[model samples]
Target: MPQGTLPTSLPADNTPKTYSGTKLVTYILAVGATGIVPPTTLTNVAAVAAAANTLTLRAAADTFIPSGSTLTFGTAQVITTADVTATAAGAAVAIQPAATPIAANATATYTNLLEVPVAEESNPTLTDQEETINVHGRITPIRVVNGKDMTATIRTLGGIDDPVVKRLITRGMSISPNNRERIIWLYPDGFALLATVNIGAPTRQAAAGNSQRVQVSANLSGGLFWANLNDPTPIWEAVNGN
Candidate 1:
């Protein structure tokens, strides 16, 4: 009937008794003390050493048992069967299930196009004119050939005052058009088109809320030719392959 001590009946003879079940031991500092130390459980208890007034209990591992403290021994209760089943079920539900990985396929797609900054609304149009030789005696034309009358119309965001637009306009208005080399229009797929173009005067249109737009018309002098943009050699000698 002391503070921090569990209520239990004492034996009539006041002699220590052996317990077969697991033993739980609690320690108290002194008599009538209020603080109750945590209990330690010992399984398969066996007396390793005994003497006239002393007995020692050994554990499987080294454990420090404090001295000068009152000890209380009690039987440790076993866990219920329902508790074990619930713990196993909860562990099984926590594990993630296996999944099948998806295989990827090869795709042919182009993400970028021209290097030059053009308006988003601009859609460049390329046109080709074919030349045919007329035979006076024959009803149908005898020889038909694709002529070098190719032209492209490109639209840009800014008007003639823009640097890029002004450069194109200057090149078109130059006195010596034949001295300039053909410019290359590059594509994302490593292919390029070469054309000695006569850049026409830029036409400008203004609106209230939108930026001024300029339309550039290019006339291919000798026609458009496909070449590799990464080729180190001359454009004429460069060989194109797959």
Candidate 2:
């Protein structure tokens, strides 16, 4: 028997017509019967124009936007060529998002207060008091320890005219205990130690043609506790869901 073959060409349609009403809906619904149709990315979009707070897109670019749909820029987006395609001659300038509010942490306000311009060194010392109890019949002695006393010495290039340095000098000159302020020692590993401190008089060393060196000392009043560098709220407060 001979093998059968299929036709290579088919008959052409002489009449063409557009589908409308229920036929158009039926065709669309049939195409999307399996699942929702996925959206496609629009390419070669022109820059957006803004006039009096109204944004307009060119006619060619309008193909990507639906007639009655609303467009929203998200928090992660910035209105600029770097973020979006708006680099045309009169394109809208970049508008950055609003700054986020700082966390209400214990040491938030004091974070930048002690930012010395040319700080050289910071030395912190913590000392504990010990009492020895000697029993007459015992060969060994028992030691009882008290709380720690914390102190710090900060060294920086002396600039008497600098506002921060001047403030430190003025605070050190006060003899009243009520002048104590909260001081935070932030570590590179995201840990911080916060303490109520009374600043002592600063000592200055001067030499010919050399910048003066200033050493400021601080005596921690209520001791210190370690916490997160940015948000140092106490563990108990966090546990209570504050």
Candidate 3:
């Protein structure tokens, strides 16, 4: 919650918890029934099928939408629609708004959309290192692509035997080398990091009333350190059987 850099005080309990931020925003209306190609500047969305009534987004069911919710798109265009209920991934639903000719680069807004929260998170930090050299007794800066590292100590609030923690541990074991998820910091500007955890382990520590607590420190790496917090789209495309 510290703004404008320069660490005013120690990082307190204002940290985030473990969760997923995969959701859709708007998609490119392909040229099928409606021949409108949306602009590329849209966020949290992908190009849908040719059908204008149906919208397509990229995400898993539990990570994108765990419950039924309504989504609306665009104010005026070729096919202006409102309150379209999005229940399933890639499933089309009907809507009614106006038959005004939709144009290219048009976007829709969904106010009630929500992101899955991280169960328990703390000790969030962002570290960056720049490689510079001095030539002719003067500093000559050279740009390097070594991105920053984002790490944190995560704790499962449900104690040592939490189901979610066990599930995450199993998932980490299965997808160790190649897996990526977004870590979004819920700030006013919506900061985020696209990262993957190659190592995952849990430990039991003594707690109040002689109980045990489950926790682990996670190291997350990305192609780049920072990202648009609002968008949870994958940074790389995965090809099957390649």
Candidate 4:
């Protein structure tokens, strides 16, 4: 090495030095290992209906993928809400033991042993006051719009009578919509929480072994990358197509 022999230039000091912005960039990390998005709700359904597929559901239902497992799928599409009754082997989901069955993805795997019913275009509709409990827990897709700790957008329209599964978005987690309901993951987050995080009223269930065993991560207002599920720091991911 020589002295001031003309340095090989330099990168911007203000810009992130990483190759991609979609990595582990977080607005805030959860404490003690759980990715918890403190309960927030979307009281304005009219505000959400502004989009074509306001509730975009992923092809598969997975919160996190265990290490050593594989995520597999066929094609790729922007998932909104998938047809549960039309998925691969997920069409037989039952709701007795609190089993949160998961749908397949481009490369995601199932650690929990619940039979996930294929999410179909037609979900069971219930009347108000009628209990909409999931006979079997499902790994459905929930979303964090504008960083509402309590409320998220699902691929399908959450029925007024159906109990939905709510959790923080897995940081850096993604789903590849191979087709209508078959999907998998590319990478997997090590640890996660599989509890029933209630946002609104319907009593969304995700008990220990019920039908739902899902994972959730947090993002600020809307970066879509790293989010603070339980952090009340007023973060906001940019709302596009609004």
**lDDT for every model?**
0.36, 0.43, 0.38, 0.23
Lowest lDDT sum, 10 consecutive residues, model 3, at 24-33
| Predicted candidate 3 versus true structure: per-residue lDDT over 1-242, tens digit per residue | 86687776855232232233232111111111112121222222444333455343222221222222223234332222332223224333343333433443344433221232333444556665446699999876576444455676655444323333454454345554532333333334555433344434656567678744556656664333344546666232321111
| lDDT for each residue of candidate 1 in 1-23, tens digit (9 for 90 to 100) | 66787659854332322111111
TM-score result, candidate 1: 0.37
- Which digits, one per residue and each the tens of the lDDT, describe model 4 over residues 1-242? 77676678765233211121222211212212233322221111111122233221232332321121111111211221222221322232211221122223223222222111222121111112222344459543344333222223222222222112211222213332111111111112421112222212222335464443232221122222222345556243332323
Order of quality (TM-score)? 2, 3, 1, 4
**Model 1 steric clash pairs:** none
Off by over 4 Å in 4: 1-19, 22-24, 27-75, 82-89, 92-242
After superposition, which runs of candidate 3 have C-alpha atoms over 4 Å from their true positions? 1-121, 133-145, 160-162, 172-175, 178-182, 187-190, 224-242
lDDT of 4 at 45: 15
* Candidate 2: Cα lDDT at 83: 21
For candidate 4, the per-residue lDDT at 158 reads: 25
Candidate 2 residue-wise lDDT, 193-214, digit = tens: 5566787888888778887877
If scored against the real structure, what TM-score would every candidate get?
A: 0.37, 0.43, 0.38, 0.15
